[model samples]
Target: MKHIRNFCIIAHIDHGKSTLADRLLEHTKTIGERDMMNQVLDDMDLEREKGITIKSHAIQINYPYKGEEYTLNLIDTPGHVDFSYEVSRALAACEGALLLVDASQGIQAQTISNLYLALDNDLEIIPVINKIDMDGAMIPEVTDQIIDLIGCKQEDILLASGKSGIGIEAILAAIVERIPAPKGDENGQLQALIFDSVFNSFRGIIIYYRILNGSIKKGDKIQFASTGQEYFADEIGVLKLTMTPKPEVKCGDVGYLITGIKVAKEVKVGDTITLANNPAPMIKGFEEVKPMVFAGIFPVNTDDFAELRDCMEKLQLNDASLTFELETSQALGFGFRCGFLGLLHMEIIQERLEREFNQTVITTVPNVSFIAYTSKGDKIIVNNPAEMPDPTKLDRIEEPFIKAQIITLPDYIGNIMTLCLGKRGILINQSYLTTTRVELTFEMPLTEIVFDFYDKLKSQTRGYASFDYSPIGYREADIIKMDILLNGDKVDALSALIHRSRAQDFGRKLCEKLKELVPRQQFQIVIQAAIGAKILARENISAMRKDVTAKCYGGDISRKRKLLEKQKEGKKRMRQIGNVEVPQEAFLAVLKLD
Candidate 1:
């Protein structure tokens, strides 16, 4: 009989998944009491800084129950919707899940979505009501709410405070009793699904998976069904809370297989790892992620370009979801065009690359997908505003839309509704949550909500707003391609698609931002906004005065030539706007108050 129970902890953002994982780790004695951090599962500095789980990490702990050791393989999943795909893959690796519901917040949209996914997987569902230590964590009421939402028997609910470590043992015991054990052919060919993986400077790749059947030791050859790559298992091990690996992990348990595979591509998430002698078919839906948001990332200093790319590559090795392509803009020097799951995902990547990679980077304004339908029946995908077709040549244009769900105190519903309406959003429905918070749904353009929307939402509701959204579809609207002209010349790098009514407002804002961002040039530079032939807004950047004093004439001639050459080189570094290659500060200056 298998002496292991594999399960994952699922919850919405900040509902205490990592904290619970820490408590479990401590309970299992996986680490010494003195060494425990507040959130040990958040191994990345970025994850801790944001107080959000970005990647899925797992650790195994052995608990002594009834005089027998029970191996508890705990997988921690990101609760943010941007990493929803990772959450789905994480669910696949476990035979069961412990749904963490915030006692005060009750059931959220993400809670429902994750629970639905858990049910579809046919994994035994174990609901754990967390946050019981909070003042608002009314356990009984939350329990009733969860039972009503899931339509499950009340007996299935496990009320526990993962924060206080209260009832944690009961929760662990329930996993052993209620959750089903992994069922696979122990005598058949070896098969395991690759749910997640991480890279260690020491160990090339740690591929996490669940063995479907059959067991082999070190020196056994294995093949990834997805990549069709074969390699000898350098070692097989279980991950403990100490974040160290044990020698040998067995069948029916969640663990990592260390092969010579140095990159993430070799061990694709959702792929099957099996014996080379007998290979199984690859699981579908394990393809590399397609980025929804794209932006140019450049180092604060030009010399850091090579370092930036190398850091990005190393980070990508650990996270396959991050995508990058080389790109250089006249405004921004050598930089990379990066793709992300969403706005938050994009920011997180940039922050992490800087923090972990030890490099500072400047980022360009993000652009969204806009579909152009021309009179000639030509279809185009415009990720950059610069690539947008002439407004006159287009028959019609549609922007991607999302169905947003906002949960907030009832008093702020009116403010939220007004804010959405002003952004061309349409109210779909409104409902009540326990007569205190209201659930409001809206169909809004993805573009409007991509930037500054979260900040605005929090500000409007005094931070009472909590919500999630997914792509609904595309809707036709009166959208115009707004162009930012610098010195009366169109800057292809600074184009945007804005609603016709908001064009002038955004144009003026863009020009103002550019003036502040662009450094004082040797020659006075003018920033302008034009729609085709008409200029909507303009700003003038004054000429910069020579600051160096030359005491020598003949001697300084050589130095002056060098100075002029340096000036020319600096001009060359700037992206060409019309006929001029501007300076680096021109790109950095445009998006700020300074």
Candidate 2:
């Protein structure tokens, strides 16, 4: 127990967390030089392509410090705000954390957020300043920032460059000396916490856990505290780049467990595992994760519903945060209403479905849950805009709100304030981190930021501003559902809930954009935006016309007039009978509008 060290790396996106993990692995010789790859822990292709971490990965490493062998269980976590829940779970399973900050970029929004998460878990933190090899590195300033943020001594902070393998040995020594070894009773009843799980076609569910007390062997019967399902432990091993089977995993050790249970849903993250016959008390678990964004995902072909569902089920085994339910749409046909942690989460899931499962899916715009109160004093919560009650029947409507924190340079503070205020954001407070950097806090509607707020902020600040947000509950506001009508027919997928004050401008812009995107047909198309019976904006797409007089060659003037009049009547009839066929691009146009 004294030689075991369990810790995780936490930092903001692109803050050298992955780079440092690679250096650590190399220094420990866990992966030979021939087998090492860039961002080894980021196993997903999407993660490498986007230069971000989506899932947390765990690995064990052996290091020799001052002639003493130490076993280090290192868990690498995602730094994005969307995966905060995953980070929290990883922190709970560890005894210490390495909080890395970029020397060039200094402290960021996620850096502060992750630090707080570690502090809340009561884990010892070792602050490290990375990226010191860069030309723009500001070591002294960042060291001061860390001192101010966490009140740690300046000498305690380690400065190193992950790109050049500087100070790697010192970091290893610090881990063994600073981080306390795992403490548990070896003879106590068996207890373990499941931090992650994956499905194997041949072996069933493979669970990743850390034993809190007692020992688990290959033949022992184990049960899940949450599900109350029992199964024989078919295999037990440690993850060292690969699964290496062992006879037993003793207390204070981290490893994987394979149960004969074939059902993927039986194993869950954050669940407790213990001996079946002499079960111990369940350990304290983390809070259940609730999704913040909801969107409807439908297969491009209706025949692929079962395939899509199967794909979702398999993916859910790896990602416990993902949620979905069967739903039918008149415009989109049969699909699932899915809930996600954020826009990034929704994008990752969609990308995985298409790339890994080879299934084509169409996703509606993401929305936050809304509360609707009817005149009869009936309360309802709506996740989809199509399910919203009639305007005449509802008395009041409330939308989810968020408390957003923005960190940027003082030079761009004015531009950020203007953007937030434009989105119906109420300024809560503003403070200065330094003479040149500032932090701004605001209370804003979740719907306003779900679409293009981040993009607009990046554009305005020149990619210097960092943002983080959390739900602040619901607030009553003046909002209305704006519907898009194509040739007098409402398109349910194109409807959205927008603030009343900006409805006219939004509606006019949407109608104009749709007119440019919708393909021209044989008959004229009238695109209208209405808030109930009143049409706020309209645009006319002229029909494609053919020259009726082209066939006339040296005809009488009376005959030409008759042909033109007959063509006019035919066009009017076609316009009345024509149905506007809105392309998929038209439904997606509203999402691109500013």
Candidate 3:
């Protein structure tokens, strides 16, 4: 165990984390040149295409230090705030973390937040300033920032360029020398923490766990402590680029287990696994994930509902942060109310369902969960606007609030403050990190930032501002349920709960967007955004007329007028009878109402 060093690399998005991991893997000779590629740990096509790491990956490598063979387990984690849960799970299985910060960008919001997470887990921190090869790299300034943030000495900060492969040897040496070896009793009771898991159709569920005590081998009877289900360990292995099967894995080692359990819902990430015959006490696992955004996910075809559920189960296994429950909408029929960490997380999950699982789905308008108190003193959790109680019956609504932190340059601070203030942000604190760098804090509603605030912040600050937020609690708000109606009928899937102050502008923009996207029919479609019985905004999509006057040519004016009148009557009848289904794009267009 003294030779085993388990650690993870964490940073803000686009801080060269994956790039650094590639260099480390190359220097350690864990992966061969033929099998190597950029962002090798980010194997998913979506991740590669987006130039981001959406999932946390684990790999084992051997590093020779002082002529002694040392085993190192490296977990490469996603840097986005939406995927912070991934970092948390990876941290739980490690004894140390590589706190990678960008030299050009200095320490950003996620860099600090992920640092706190590592500190909370009692993991040793190795601060490495990456991307020092960049032209704009500020090595000295970033070093001071790191020192001030972590209270570490000047020499403790390592300077490395992931792009040019500089300081790779020093980083490896630091991993071996600074990071402590995992401690566990190989002869103690069997106790392991299941940090992550994935589903394989042919092999059942494959789980990645770090053994805290004792050992496990093939054919051992293992039980999930939470579920109390026992299964035979069909395969035990250590993780390589591809899994390498082994006879057994000992304490303080991170490895994978294949139990041949076909059901995806049966296995839970963060669940403790122990020998069923000689069970160990449950290990403290992760806290339940509180999702920041909620939306509806329905199959394009109702018959595929069961298959989508199965796909969601497998997805939830891989992503423990995603939460879902069966929900039925008046307009969309059967679907699941899915909770996600943020909009990006929701988008990735929706895309993964389509690409990976071959499930075609329709995503509705995303909204934050709300707590509604009724006149009868009953509290209701409203995840869907369609679930909101009647106006007369509801006493008040409480919405989630978050304390947001933004670190940016002095030049963009004014624009950022204006943008955030427009979102109803309240100024809490402001300070300067250096002569040119500033950090601003605000208390704002979580719903305000759920949609376009991030995009606006990036655009306003020219992508220089880094933002991070944590939910504070619920606060009373004058929120109303806004319903969209097409041709006088409500579309429940297009309903949303919004603040009363911004409801009119939001409704107007939504109606305009829908008008631009909805197809024209034989009759005019009246699109209305309404709150309760009052219509807040409206738009009309003109009918695709046949031009009855074109055929009337040179006839008497009365005759032409008579023809037009009859046509108008027919159109009015058609409008009364014609039923409209809200376009799928219209639902998603609400996300871009910038």
Candidate 4:
């Protein structure tokens, strides 16, 4: 057990986390020169395209130090704020973490956020400065920032360039000399913490776990603590570049267990796996995920609802952070109200459903969850706008607020302040981190930043600003549920709860955006944005004019008038019975009203 060192790498997005992992893999000789590729840990196509880690990856490598071989387990974690849940779980399964910071970008928002997560888990921190090969790299500045953030000595921080393979030997030596070996009772009953899982069409669910105590041999009967269902362990193996079957995986080691869990609900991510006969107590350290964004996803064809459900269930096994429940919309038919970590997480899931499962889905407008109090003092949670209570029966609505942290250059601080204030944000505090860097804090509603706030911030700062946020709590607010009515028919899918002060301007933009997207029909279509019974904004698409009057060139004025009146009557009837076919793009346009 003294020879085994388990650690993970945590940093902000694009802070050279994956690049450093690749270098480490090469230094340890885990893969051959010809077989090695960039971002070998990031196997998903979506992840490769986006250049981000969407899932946590774990691999074991053998290293030689001081004439002795040591087994090192490395868990590479995602750095995006949306995928922070993955980072937390990865940090929990390790004894130490490499807090990687970018030399060019310095310590950003996620660097501090992930650092706190590591601190909470009581893990040994090894600070490392990466990307030192860049032309704009500020090694001394980043080292000072790291010192200020973690309070580590100057020599304690390691400086390395992931791209140039500098300081790889030193990093390897630090892990073996500094990080302690995993400690557990090897002779006790089997207790393994399941940190991650993946679904295989041919082999069922493949669970990735780290043994907390005891050992598990191949073909042992195992039981999951959460489900209480027992199954024979069909395969037990350690994770290399590929799955290598081993006869036994003992305590203080990380490996995969295959029990042929074909059902999605049968396997839980954080559940404990123990021997069915001499089961160990369940590990209750992991917390239930609190999703930050809410959206509705429905199948394009209503008949594909069952297939969509199957796809969602399988997807959830891979992404445990996603939460969903059955939902119905008058306009969208049967769908699921999905809770996502953020907008990017929601988009990734939608794309994965289509690209991986071949399931085409429509996503409704994204919003943050709200709490409502009824006139009778009943509390209701409103995730969808349709779930909002009647105006007369409602006491007040409380929306979720978040404490946002923005780290940017001093030049763009003014613009950043304006952007936050425009979204109903209150300035909490501001401080200067360095001569060039300034940090600002604000308190704002979660709903205000759900759309294009990130995009706007990036553009305003010229990609120099880094932002992070956490939910503070709910607060009372004057908000209303606004709905879009087409020809007096309410579209439940287009409804949203908005702040009362900005409703009129937002409604006008939405109505105009919808007008440009919805296709024209024979009859005129009226798009009305309404709050309760009062309409706030309206846009009209005129009916396609026909040549009915062109055929009466020689007719009298009275005959032309008669034909026109008859045409008007027919158009009116069409408007009553004809259904408006809202295209898929129209639903997406609601998210890009700006």
In lDDT terms, which candidate is top? Answer: 4
Task: Assess the local accuracy of residue 571 in candidate 4 as a C-alpha lDDT between 0 and 100.
Answer: 98
Model 2, runs deviating above 4 Å: 260-262, 553-579
State the lDDT of candidate 2 residue by residue for 499-559, as single tens digits: 8998899899999998888889877889999999899999999989888888888958988
lDDT of 3 by residue, 1-594 (tens): 899999999999999999999999998889999999999998889999999999899999899999999999999999999999999999999999999999988889999999999999999999999989889999999999999999999998899998889999999999999999988889999999999998888888899999999999899999999999999999999999999999999999999999889888788888899999999989985887889999899998888899899999999999999999999988778999999999899999999998999998989888899999999999999988878999999899999999999999999988988998999999999999888789999999988988889988999999999999999999999999898899989988888899999999999998999999988999999999999899999999999888888877786799889989999999999988888767778778888787
Q: Please, what is the whole-model Cα lDDT of each candidate in the order they appear?
A: 0.77, 0.89, 0.92, 0.93
Candidate 2 positional error at 481, Å: 1.0
Q: List the residue pairs that clash in candidate 3.
A: none
What is the Cα root-mean-square deviation between model 1 and the actual structure? 6.0
**TM-score, cand. 4 vs. native:** 0.99
lDDT of 4 by residue, 314-354 (tens): 99999999999999999999999999999889999999998
Query: What local lDDT does model 4 show for residue 340?
Result: 98
Model 3, global lDDT: 0.92
Q: Clashes in each model (backbone N, CA, C under 3 Å)?
A: 5, 0, 0, 0
- TM-score to native of every candidate shown: 0.88, 0.95, 0.97, 0.99
Please report how far candidate 4 places residue 32 from its true position, in Å. 1.2
CA deviation > 4 Å runs, candidate 3: 547-562
Q: At residue 455, what lDDT does model 4 achieve?
A: 92
- Sliding window of 10 residues with minimal summed lDDT for model 2: 581-590
Give the clashing residue pairs of candidate 4, or none: none
Q: Which prediction has the highest TM-score against the true structure?
A: 4
Models ranked on TM-score = 4, 3, 2, 1
